[model samples]
Target: MKRVALLVLPALLLAGCAAKEAEPASAGLTVTGRYPLEYAEQFTIDECAGGYSLVTIGEERYLVVPEDAPLPTGLEQDLTILQQPIENIYLVSTSVMDPIISIGALDSIALSGTQADGWYLRQAREAMENGEIAYAGRYSTPDYETILNADCGLAIENTMIYHTPEVKEQLERFGIPVLVERSSYEENPLARMEWVKLYGLLLGKKEQAEQQFAEAEQRIAPLADQPSTGKTVAFFSITSNGLATVRKGNDYVARMIEMAGGDYVFADLTDNGNNLATVNLSLENFYAGAKDADVLIYNSTIEGEVDSLAALLEKCPLLADCKAVQQGNVWCTAQSLFQQSMELPDLILDMNRVFTQENPPESELKFLTKIQ
Candidate 1:
C-alpha cells in the first residue's frame, strides 16, 4: 500500500466556525506519525496517551494503535485495542459502506451485515452478488462461525451493536478487534462527513479522504451566508401506533435544516443532555406544534414511503390542518437517505431549494419526493 502524508488543515466545526489547526507540519510527503482530527471530538490522537489514539463513542472507548507502533503503556483491559492496517474487515455499519467504497478500498471489506437486496448502493449490492462480499448476519445476531472461518481481522460496528455487548466480547474471543463508528453523533453534517478521514487513515488512503471532504465542504460553501428564508420546517415520521417521531433540534438533521436557511419547527424540544436523535411524540402534540410549519418533510426512512398526499393524510388525518399540508408543501424523503451518507451535501442543496423556492426544480432533487 502507498502511504500518503496528509495535513489536517482548518476544517468545519460546529456553528459554521473554522477549526484551528492543531500544529504546524513540515512540507512534502513525510509521515508525521500522528493522526490529527479536525472535527471529530469523540476521538483524539495523543502521543502522551501512550502513543495510541483514544476514540470515545457514546459510553464505549477504544484504543487504536498502528500495527507497527509500540503498545501504549498503562492501557486498561476494558478498552478494545485496534492495531491498524485493518484489512479483512467485517463492516457492520451500512452507512460506512459508501465512504469506504469511495476511497477505492472496497476490496478491503470481507463481510457485510446487510443483505444484497437490502443495500441501496449499487456497488455494495453487486459485490454481494458477485461473492466479493459475504453476509454474516447483522450487528446483534452475527454468524460467529462464518466470521471466524473467514478470519476477519477487524470488525467495524455502528452504535446499534452497543446494545449487544456480548457480541463484541464473542468476536474479541476469536482475536478480532472491534471499533465502533460514531460519526452519526456529530452535530454538524460536515463534521460527520469529515469522519471519512478516520477511515482513510486506517486504510492508508488519507489523501483521498481529505480531498473528498474538501469537495463536500465546497459544495456547501455557497449556503453558509445565504439569507434565511424564515420558512419553518417539520421533519417527522409517523409510527404504526400513531406517535410522531422527530429529530431533536440539536441533531445533525435538524442542524442541516437550519443551515439551509429554514427554521426547524421543533427547536424547543432540544435538551442538551438528551443524546438520542429522535423523540417520540403524541400525535396530538405533534399536530399542535407542527400545524403552522411552512414545509413538511416526511422521514420515510422510519415511517415508510407514502405514494401520495392522500396516503399521507390517511395515515394522519390531523395533519390536514398543518399549514404545509393545506398549502400542498409536503415531501417525503427516500429510504436511501440514511444509508447514502456521501450524498449529504446534495441533500442540503435540495432542502435549500425547497425552503427558498415556491416550486423547486424537482428534476435535480436527490432524496426528496414531492407529495402529489
Candidate 2:
C-alpha cells in the first residue's frame, strides 16, 4: 500500500490569517458566514489526495475536498474545538507567555507550568487568580495527564520537546496537539514577538496578536537610534555546575541589550539555532572578556532575595574583579528568560527600562514587581 502523506499545516502561514475576513466563496463549500477556526476545529481538518487538500475554515491555507476521500489506514482521527477562544492555555515555556498575556489572552489561560509569583509570571498573576488558573508545576514536570483532563485545547511547548520525545509522543497519543514555539530561539526580539501570531492562529485571535506586535515594534525601533554613553553589558546563565554560560552573539537577550542601547560583549559569536550556543568560557577566559563589562545581569532561580548573585560570584573567582561587580552594576533578575515562549515583548520593555536612562517608566511597569 502507498503510504499517504499527512497533510501538514505550516504554522507560519496559519498564523498570518488568524483574524482575516472570511472569504465568500471557498471552492464549492459555501463556508456559511466564515468565522475564525476555533482551537479544536483548527486541527480536525485532515489532508486528502496524497496530502494536497485540507478541510477547514480559518486563516490557514486549507483545501476543500470531497468528504469520501480515504484517510491513511491506522491513523487516528479526533475532533477538538476551542470553546472559549483559548482563555485558559497551559504554558510549557515562559519565554513567550507574557507576550501572549500582554496581548489580552491572560484570562483564557487555564494553567501555567511556572508559578505566578515569578517576575514574568506576575504579568498574568491577576488574571490567573481571578480566573482561577491552576499551576501544574515546572516546565520539566508539567502534569500532562491533568492538563489534558482539564480540557486544555492547546499546549504551547518549547523546543525542549526534542529532549523528551516520549512526552511529545504521549501528548499526540492523547489527541492533544503540541505547537512548537521557537521565539526563544529567535535572534531578534522583534522576530520573537512576530511569533505571537502563532498563538493567535490557534485561538482565532490573530488580529490581536498582530496589533500587539506592531505596537511593541513601534516602541522599540526608536531606541535603535538613541545614543548610548554607558559601558557595555553581558548576560549569562549560571548552570548547575556553576559554569557561566554566555549567551551567543545571536541570542535574543543579546539583541535586547543592543536594542536597549547597550553593547553586547558577545555579539560576535554565531548562534547555533538553538537557544544556546557553543561559547564556553572558563574563569580566565570570562575574566579576559568581561573584566571591563559595564553591567552584568545574572539569571537567578531563587525569588525574593538578592543573595544568589553573591553566592554565584563567591563560587566563581574570575567574577570577583570584574568591573560590573566592582562598581555595583550587577543585577539579579529571574531566570524566566530561559523558558519564555510568547512573552518577549515585555522582556524587551523590561530591558529597555533597566538599560536606558532617558526613557520614562510606563504605567505598566508599576504593576511589574521584580522577583527581589
Candidate 1 per-residue C-alpha lDDT over 184-270 given as tens digits, one digit per residue, 9 for 90 to 100: 888888878888887877777879998888898899899998989999999999999989999988789998998899999898787
What C-alpha root-mean-square deviation, in Å, does candidate 1 show against the real structure? 7.1
- Score each candidate by Cα lDDT: 0.78, 0.56
For residues 1-372, what per-residue lDDT tens digits would candidate 2 score against the true structure? 111122433222222122233332322222233332222222323322232223342322333322234322221132122222343467776665666665677655677776657535665676556657788766567687667666765566776777887876666566555555555555676766666655555445668987876776777666667777465887765555655668788777787787767888878877555445436667677677788988777655422224544675665767888887776666665455444544455655666676654333445442122321
The 10-residue segment of model 1 with minimum total lDDT is 23-32
How does model 2 fare in lDDT? Answer: 0.56
Q: After superposition, how far is residue 65 of candidate 2 from its true place, in Å?
A: 14
* Native-referenced Cα lDDT, model 1: 0.78
Candidate 2 to native Cα RMSD, angstroms: 8.7
Candidate 2: stretches off by over 4 Å: 1-88, 115-120, 123-131, 135-145, 227-230, 272-279, 301-312, 334-372
Q: What is the lDDT of residue 115 in candidate 1?
A: 93
